[model samples]
Target: MADEEYISVEEVASIMGLSVRQASRYAAKVRTERINQRVLFHRDDVMEQARLKGIEHEARERAATYQPKPTKTDLVPAGEMLEYIRERDRQLAEVQAQLNQALLEIGRLQGQLTDHQQIRQQLTDIQSERDELKQAMERARPWWRRILGHD
Candidate 1:
């Protein structure tokens, strides 16, 4: 056993693998002492509480070993990752080409629409001129031809 001196709440929590507040809650169920203007719990009392909770050995074993988790770059192979990137780039290029082709088609359709509208306006003007020429020709025919519905 260690000395019978009072231990800090932080130290007890560290040994028991608990947060300070949680350890304080458990420490309240055991013996504690005030030292140097601070409340302190006994090491034996906290350790006894931890043992009763069945986590004392687990905390000690975790503190003994050190192993890091594997990262993404460590889990995947470099050659396979490069092939995936190439496939993604090829798909992106295909989509971009389709978009450019669609834009060009839209421009061509817009030009045809403009030409169609101009042709419609020209046809309207020609119809109005033909009606005027027919009226003038009828007036020159001395109004008798118009009554007969002829030129």
Candidate 2:
């Protein structure tokens, strides 16, 4: 036992190009010893088993397809992000100003419409009063004068 070398499960994982969990399962198929609540396997035995199972080829294939995640350094800087936000806010404010201008124009047009309606109503009232006064003047005039067609 002293002459032979023992490797930890983590070392077996690295050697087999497997994750720790996969390495643990693989180690169970071979001879394993528990020491200090940690599983240890003979490195030579683990490598031989991997060669027999053709796992080394699969590990190589997985590595070829692996892509690491992007880190914080890959992101846009804080100043650039703040500038983009400010630009968007400026565009939004311009749109809001145009909307407010349209609202003011609509209010002005509505005021003109109200003035036109009042003017129309006053014209109608004036026409009614003119008709009443004409009728009263006709009644006041003598019937003989109307027959003569004189004003």
Best lDDT goes to which candidate? Answer: 2
Stretches of model 2 off by over 4 angstroms after superposition = 1-63, 69-77, 147-150
Q: Each candidate's lDDT (Cα)? A: 0.76, 0.78
- The TM-scores, one per candidate, come to 0.48, 0.48
Error of 1 at 47 (Å): 10
Q: Model 1, 9: alpha-carbon shift in Å? A: 19
Q: Give the residue spans of candidate 1 off by over 4 A.
A: 1-69, 145-151
Error in Å for residue 34 of model 1: 28
Model 2 steric clash pairs: none
**In candidate 1, which residue pairs clash?**
none
Task: Judge candidate 2 against the unseen true structure and give its global Cα lDDT, from 0 to 1.
Answer: 0.78
Model 1, span 1-151: residue lDDT tens: 2344566666666767777787778656877886677667776677677789898787656434424446678987999999999999999999999999999999999999999999999999999999999888777886776788875
